[model samples]
Target: MPKRLRLTRRFPVAMTNDAYRRLQSFAREAELTQDEALTFLFEHFNSVTNHENLTARLRLFRAELEARKA
Candidate 1:
């Protein structure tokens, strides 16, 4: 069987050393790339939380930060 192609984009993020290490461990255990691990986490979190509200709040917070920087 042929492998399916997946389109992806680069998304750089900052994290604490401990968090980074934990994510690395998770990826290794799941046999996935860090990106895949992050995607899994995000989807799980969304399912457990109010995803739309969280996304709106995050967008607003980012906009405020950018406005302050400007």
Candidate 2:
């Protein structure tokens, strides 16, 4: 049986529309609610993420963030 999860934190999140759409898609594909999908992702972050790819993407996003805010 799968372990049950209790939501212990709630906070506001802000993301680009593209990112939000991707999150919705992932949640639908996984048959989980958006919150649950986020929880699962964060919980298994290390195992599911590609470290090199994430590092490169983070750099790109950070570089663009300032421009996006304008």
Candidate 3:
């Protein structure tokens, strides 16, 4: 078995009460520590943002092709 390397860093952030509550609820539901919950959220956000960027680029390319054909 291969050993895994761990690199941990800390980031301090301040949020509104509402945001804190939402994060707390998510952490409880997912059975994750606050740090883990935040990591999950960051990863999910990156995926969604990447998908949106790709979709926007595809739309622009299709529009350009249609304009050139006309």
Candidate 4:
């Protein structure tokens, strides 16, 4: 059985009408409910952060090095 997710945060966001329409179109095209689309987006974003966190950290380190040189 799939585990149920307990939502912990509620934040309000504002989007332009164009963005709203595009999101609706994507949900229809992908056959995803709005909640499913949001979940998918969060999962993908987390995956990218997991993969790139080390690289991002290294970039920060490089930025500090350049700052010290300057």
- Candidate lDDT scores, in order, read 0.81, 0.97, 0.79, 0.74
* Model 1 residue pairs with clashes: none
Model 4 misplacement above 4 A: 1-8, 46-70
Which candidate gets the maximum TM-score versus the true structure? 2
Q: Sort the candidates on TM-score, descending order.
A: 2, 3, 1, 4
Q: Which candidate is the best by lDDT?
A: 2
Worst 10 residues of 2 by lDDT: 1-10
Estimated TM-score for each candidate:
0.52, 0.89, 0.55, 0.49
TM-score, candidate 4, is: 0.49
lDDT of 4 by residue, 6-69 (tens): 5666678677587788878878888987666666678777564666786898789788976755
Candidate 1 residue-wise lDDT, 5-55, digit = tens = 363766779875887999999999999998888877775885756878988
lDDT of 2 at 1: 95
Count of clashes in candidate 2: 0
Q: Per-residue lDDT tens digits of candidate 3, residues 12-69?
A: 8988588799999989999988888887777587664678787898799788976756
C-alpha RMSD values across all candidates: 5.7, 1.3, 11.1, 8.2
Worst 10-residue lDDT window for candidate 3 reads 2-11
